[model samples]
Target: MLIGEVARHSGVSPRMLRHYDALGLVRPTGRTVGGYREYSAEDVRRIFHVESLRSLGLSLKQIGRALENPSFTPSALVGDLIRWTEDRLARERELLGRLRAIDASAPAGWQDVLRIVELMQGLNSASPARRLQTVLARPEGVSVPVGLLADAVLAESDPNVAGALRWALARSGGDGVAALAAGVHAEDVDIRRRAVLALAGMSEVPGVAAALADALGDPDPTVRGRAALALGRRGVTAAVPALVGMVVEGSSDVDAAEVLGTLSQDPGCAVRITTALVDELAAPAADSATRIRLTQALVELPVTSVLEVLRQLAHDDDPAVALVASAWVGVLDERSAEDRGDEDS
Candidate 1:
């Protein structure tokens, strides 16, 4: 076959075939009387082989080594190609995410597009301070897409950056609630915790309460505690059990106790919260420390609501428990006395 026939059959262009020949990739075996290049069957087969290697992303130099170097093993080269392809795919995925974020922002012009791009880059900066500064420095009236903020807050590991990202998300009202809700169910324990924390600050948002409610059952105690505390403050009685658990477990007991005390302001929820605390205090497994923490938590409740429980606990088996409970009872009685005195005067 001549060069043109070889090109027609192999789908390799004539110029490329000539280039291959020049590179000693597939030199034709003979030439006609007019001195045109002619290819033997063997030469045509080598052309197909070169094309096959190119399809596998082999550079011409690599192909040359593959075809001509008897000592060359394909394992290392193939591994390199795999890694290179993987890197390219990762870059493409990142670019796609950026483009989606920009489109979601609904940029009005090239400037808006550029600004969103810059903001996204800052949010994803390697330095935690840079990410935090990016979130804090966002100018007023420049609305970042809430989804972008949700993604950043969910993935953020740095404490400061995560806090700033949550603040940014809260400023968007309920917009990021769905994304954060999805993060609440994420398999990554850290992500679920972050999502709950972010949602905790957005309790006023429409869907936030429900998401936090769902997070109350999260496997991570931190997630459950944050969710329970947020809901407790929102007057949701559903958080009663978890809040009592937090107090019993001595995890964030102070904040949990404070929120529970606030929740007890609702007459109906007050009964349930008090009962849950009393139940935990009465549990057979309640150690002295657990009883003490539960006793302390009772101080947040309305004195009238928990006075009976406190009276019973004041003489409890554990000296530490009795001491703490008696102290709180005295404080409550003194306040009650003061209220009555003021009324009379």
Candidate 2:
């Protein structure tokens, strides 16, 4: 076969085949009387082999080594090729993500596109301070892509950066809620914690409440506690059990008590919250310290039923608890007496 015929059959262009010959990747085995390059069967086979290697992303130099150097083992070269391919793939993926983020922003012009790209790059900076500064310095009234913020929020380990990201997401509202919600289900507990924290800041958004409801059952106590705190404040009765658990565990017990008090302001949930507190107090697992926290939580509830429970607890076995319950009940009793006397007068 001649050069043209070889090019036609092998799908390697004539120019590329000539370059291959020049590089000694493949050379014609003979020439005709006119001195045109001619390829024997072995030469054509070599051309196909070169094309095959090129298809696998081998450079011309690498192909030369592969074909001519007996010392060139496929193992090392293939390993190098694999690493190179992987790096290229990672770069492509990153570029694709940036393009998608830009598209999702629906940029109005080249300036908007550049701005979003810059913000994304800064958010992904290696330095935590840079990421936080990027979030804090976000342009006002210019739309920051919420998905980018959501991703930064989940991946951010620095507390300051995480808070700024959450603040940014809160202002951006519903745009990032979907991504934030997905982060809530991530296998990494830290990610789940970050997701819930971000959502907790944005719980006023339409779907965020529902997402938080799902996070109430998170396996991580920190994750569950944050979710429960957010949900309880929203007056979701489903959070009652977890909030009660927080009181017993003394993790943010004060805040949990305050939220429970707010929830109990509803006549409907008052009895339920009261019953939960009493049950924790009665549980054998409720150690002295646990019972003390639970007792303190009772002061936040204004319901009349808590008075009776406090009275019973006033004379309990733990003198410290008894003193706390008795003093608290006495204070409530005195306040009630004052009100009754004023009404009678």
Candidate 3:
């Protein structure tokens, strides 16, 4: 077959066939009287082989080696090709994600498109300061796409940047609640923690309570703690056990105690919260420190509700716990006296 006939039958262009010949990748072995290049059957088969390797993302140089070198192994090269294709696919997916975010923003013009692109680039920047500045410097009233903020907040590692992103999400009127909710179940502990932290601030948003409720079972105590605290603030009774556990475990015990205190404002919830704490205190596993922490938490409850527990604790065997409980009993007595005196007046 001549070059044109080879091109016609094999779909390889004449110019590319000539280029392949010049590179010694697939040189035609025959020539006519007019001295035009002619390809033998084997040469045409080599051309197909080169095209096949190119389809697998092999460079021309690599293809030449693959075809010519007897020692060349396809296994390692195929593995490398798989990785390179994966990397290319990942880049394409990321670029597609950026485009979707930009499109989701519904930019009105080229300028808006530029601004959104710039914001995304800044959020992804290597410098934490740049990421922080990007979030902070967003022009007022230019609503960033909620999805963009959601993605940023989930992946952000720097404390300050994460806080800013959460604040921005909050100000977006809870638009990113679903994304943050999904992050609550993320495999990464840090992402789960960040998601709950962001959700904690958006309790007023619909579905946030449910998301936090789901987070109450998170294996990470920090995620569960934040979720419990958020739910406790919302007066969700389901948070009682976690909040009480927080107090007993000394994980954000102060904040947990404060929320428990707030939840105790309800007469029924007050009984439940107080009973849970007392149960933990009475558990055999309760150590001195645990007892002491539980005792301090009791101080946050209503004096009337916890007075009996404190009085009993005041006479407890542990001297440190007894001292703390004794002091709280006296403080409650004084407060009760002050109230009684005012009522009498």
The most accurate candidate by lDDT is 3
Where is the poorest 10-residue window by lDDT in model 1? 163-172
For candidate 2, list the clashing residue pairs, or say none: none
- Residue-level lDDT of model 2, residues 1-345, one tens digit each, is 899998889888999888877877788989899999999999988887887898999888888887787777798878988999999999998888789889989988999999998998898899998888888877678787777778888889999988888887887769899998999999998899999988888857999889999998887889999999999889898999999998998889999999999999988798899999998899988799999999999989984869999999999999989999999998999998998999999
Query: Looking at candidate 1, what is the lDDT of residue 290?
Result: 90
Off by over 4 Å in 1: 1-88, 139-141, 340-345
lDDT of each: 0.90, 0.88, 0.93
**TM-score of candidate 3 relative to the true fold:** 0.82
Error in Å for residue 185 of model 2:
0.9
Q: In candidate 2, how many Å is residue 343 off?
A: 3.1
Give a tens-digit lDDT track for model 1, residues 257-285. Answer: 99999988888888988889898888999
Ranking by lDDT: 3, 1, 2
Better structure of 2 and 3 per lDDT: 3
Q: What are the runs in model 2 whose C-alpha is more than 4 Å off?
A: 1-90
TM-score of 2: 0.76
